[model samples]
Target chain A: MSTPTETETPSETETEGGTRLSYETRDRLYHLALYGSAALFSAVILFPIYWMVQNAFTDSQTVITEFSWLPSPETVTLDNFSVLAAGAVPRYVINTIVVTAGTIVVVVGVSLVAGYGMARFRFRYKESFAQFLLLGYMFSPIVLGLPLYLIWSEIGLLNAQIGLVIALSSISMPFAVWLMWKYIQTIPESMEESAWIAGASRWRTFWDVVVPQTKPAIVACALFAFAIAWNDFTFAQILLPSQESTTFAPGIMRLIDQGGYTSWGDIMAVSLLMTVPPLLFAYFLQEYLLKGFEVRTR
Target chain B: MTVHIDNMTRVFDSPNADRIVAVDELSLTIEDGEFLTLVGPSGCGKTTTLRCVAGLDTPTAGTIRVDDRDVTELPPQQRDVALLFQDIALYPHMSVRKNMEYGLKIAGVPEDERREHVAEAAALLQIGDQLDKMPASLSGGQQQRVALGRSLVRDPSVFLFDEPMSDLDAKLKRELRPVVQRITDEIGCPVLYVTHDQEEAMTMSDRIAIMDDGELQQAGSPKEVYSEPINDFVGEFIGQPAMEFFDAHVESANGTAAVSMGDHTVSLPATADELEGYVDSPVRVGVRPQQIGIGDPAEGIEAEHVLDEPLGDETHSIFETEFGDVTVVTHADFDGDGDTEYGLVLDESATQLFDPDSGVRIH
Candidate 1:
């Protein structure tokens, strides 16, 4: 209940009368240690990203050398990217973009209406429906892979873009619901009520007042979905493996498989290629991204 | 311009479809251009009544008429009303121009008129420069003006203000009140302002309608309500220092009418001739803090000073008198103790008396 003396009036209490030399030494030591560890940790975290780009330019000749962290003159080249691009891989990038875009549309659009319903309206099984949607998040997707493959195969949706869309979207919906619910809760109920009284229809209030205020959250939700759908390898590998339907993830894995493990340049290049879409989306939406996480309260 | 509500009621039925009446079967008429405030404590149905009139929520059983036309089943837009909410719900993503432009667009105003109106409201509110800025970029007061501008573009006939100034600091509230007064005056429409803060109601409304426990307790002009409250609730709800209430009895001291408390007699003005026969009945006396001046300790009825609040201009001194602990506002300051001997003299014109049991104010 009581604030500490140091926090109450720090200048007066930080060091009564004078700073101890030993304490200053300890403090400087702590600062050095913190920045040092942070720098080391940042390098460790970004190493894979750095290695991906590094490996992309390096050819198969030197990738398996003890030089994972460096580029060797004998093995560094653009041949892997050229080889990948020469085939149907570029087409697969288009397919991946199509599938991810499709998934984002369904995920964002459905979650928005569903989130608003679960947040503001009254209906039968409202709570239970929300729970039912959330139930999709309970288990690992690997467990359902077999059944999903069989279902899609039986439905004749296997090896199609729509199959990838449905697969990735179903995986992303529960998360979308949960985040959207939390985001919508932050907008005070009075805000929508005000719109109601301000002569906006129920639907108008959603579009005019609620949706505008929620843009930051919605964009952040899109970013989350984009990340999930883009990086997804399992469903794309399992559901769409036909010649024309292969996505970026499955295409990259197949390239690495055929080109042997030493083609570090190809592997790393594809990894870095996948990172650019999210990195670009996040870079452009940096402001909303910050705002989305900032909890709003009335 | 006129508002008529008959048998209005709203029941909250979620937890148990067993109804909890927020606004009970209430009915009233508001004259054209009347700045009537629905004032009460929280959960007192004041806001609910305003919401019903605004068509934000449908009443369980009732009809609402605005300007002689039924709007009970109509939604807010169809009812021709605009509400300035407590949160000032301006869209954060849009510039102030777009924010105000939305209502006009919805109302089917032409682009030229919408632009002209947005500019006019912005300039009228002195927020012309903020038109290009998003709502998040403006200060709270400016954002509120944008909300007002949005409503102004709609040009609705009825203005509903739901505690619009409740979120601002005291200083900003004081600054914004006169601006609101100017805008409402220029528009001259029927206005329903809802607030639990009686000070705002007293300052902003032409008539203050006091709501309590899902019922209308009393309604009158601010001055009339202050001078002649219908009950203890109205008296207590209105006034700055609030009316001091005391449980006493009407008595005739040998042919002279007076109220006696523990050997002390308040010889009320003889104009109160109606209480001539009500001699032995217990009564409640209400007096405003402003009406009583603390005189010389030896000249008037004695009391003790309990506490004093200096509100810059006038000092509110609470004194424990024989009748009750009374509030007195004065410019002078003095240190006093328990039974420190303070005299009291009432401006009988401003004091009210009520029935002790029923709390009905008696003239």
Candidate 2:
């Protein structure tokens, strides 16, 4: 079906004195080029992941040699994964997992309620208070390093998993609260009113009526907060004083060392391992993440 | 189910404070199964009156009773009255059944009975097909029906409508007004409906109360309120294009009096014996547009057509005359010009006379 009422190139020319090509052919060619270019561009964007995996599978020498312009069979091997098992990569991976999981749970749980209250409740200087909370995100971690280190040391929290969890959650809280605030505001006021009129108290209304509607944004917010906390290098650098307690970024930094020879294969394997959890988290939360960003423009 | 208000006037602020007197010393009775409507212009006390009856507001001064029981001191739930606001406050997140079941659930009705009431209401509103659908999924008219259903499930002794159909479109208003009328009639539950639109009041009420300036101007059947307005305000507020009033004089001769208005004269022959002593009394006399007609051009009381407002069915001609601006609807155009001299005859028997200074009906 076509919107024939519109003036196409050839039709405008044939009917109203123009010098363009026939409109039907031009319209067909336009849509065809549109779809073809879209697919080509999306494939180009995904090509790096495919190259990374293919190179990961190759034997060490062959993989390096055949890391060419395209995918090849002879240069693939599992040596990269084997080399990383002998290093501290596995323990580093476990440390990253604990930190990311702990940060996500605490952040999402605390932030949803705080955000809901901030957005829905009217209080004295509530807006200013919210802006003040977000001010935590304004300072560079490098600048806060000395202060954070001293604070942690005074409390004997330095180089600890609990300290990492606290640090990550505090950093990610402002973003979570802001995202949830915007999303929860969209749920209709009538829902809560009805719940109230139905004899449910305000808390019951939040949990039963308002909370269910905000799941998509909450899921997306958790993933985003987790990704940010998991990939953070500065807090890890400042807090970890020992390799035994180091997370992925600091662990990897310690591994490379002040040596001439760098463990290229093991580093690649650890980098690949460090990227997996976020990729999986994002994959499961793909729908909400897409919707979360979609609503930004709309 | 009795409501009583004593000195129940609601002043939002203090005695000397700036405020709008929504219900100004308004008092009335809603006998068991009697449907009463508080009709008025905006800012009149109609809505306030309904809210007072619903126990939504405490009246500053007055008493309300349902079956002679004093309910003025009660809360909404204790008042046993269901209020339907003009905004149709339905729960958008709930299904039609859930919406209907909501109030019942709040009142602690058992699950089975709640389902029974919801089902019955759903059937009554013909929204059974939409029982599982959320309110956002329904059309505007359907939402109104669901709101009605929600109130219906409450099964209160009285129903108070606060301009309920005012938010609806013309067609839907036309469609739902009669349904509401029929339900209120069938239920025989004393209903106090409030609306600012006179037409909605006329079509829906067995009795219409015209209000202005925080007071009830007149309360009676539609015909009585229109034909026998108690004052100039009621006279001017009731009819389409309103009742025309102008300064006129009464003079006596041969024991009979004639009311003179410019070049026009109407007899008070019907009230000759009744109005024997009154002469040269200045009064404001009213005539309806429907009453005055295209009389014989040479014989009738004379008027000049100043302008003609062509409503689809009939053309109304406004005349700037010796008396005042008089308007009449004429089916046939007497002249093509915008302003032309024309003649009119007042139906003297139907014409009403009021004392101009006090605006009270005189004889």
**How much does each candidate deviate from the true structure in C-alpha RMSD?**
5.0, 6.2
Error of model 2, residue A104, in angstroms: 5.6
lDDT tens digits, residue span B207-300, model 2: 7777787776788887888778888888888878778887888866344458887666777654566554546777787888877776554545
The model with the greatest DockQ is: 1
- In candidate 1, the residue pairs with backbone N, CA or C atoms under 3 Å apart (3 or more residues apart, or in different chains) clash, namely A55-A265, A59-A75
Q: lDDT per prediction?
A: 0.79, 0.74
Model 2 DockQ reads 0.14
Name the docking class for model 2. Answer: incorrect
Off by over 4 Å in 1: A1-52, A62-69, A124-128, A194-199, A259-265, A282-288, A291-298, B14-19, B253-255, B269-273, B295-301, B311-313, B322-324, B331-339, B347-350
Put down candidate 1 lDDT per residue, B1-363, tens digits, no spaces: 888889898888877576678988888777877888889999998888888888878889988998779898887767778889898877655688988888777767899988999899888899999888877778898888888888777777888899998999998898888888877776788888999989899998899888888988888899888877889999888888888876767776344457765555677764446774567878877778788877866655577889878877778888876766778887755445565577877765666778887888875
Indicate the worst ten consecutive residues by lDDT in candidate 2 chain B: B333-342
lDDT score at residue B62, model 1, on the 0-100 scale: 86
Roughly what TM-score does model 1 have, to 2 decimal places? 0.88
Candidate 2, residues A1-298, lDDT tens digits: the string is: 2576764655557776565666676778898999999989988987766656655665656654444765466655677887566666777777888888889898888888987887788788888887988899789888877798999999999989889889889888888888788887876564564455445567867876777667777797688778877898889888877777778888888776838766555666667777787888888689666775554333
The TM-scores of all predictions, comma-separated, are: 0.88, 0.73
lDDT of 1 at B249: 76
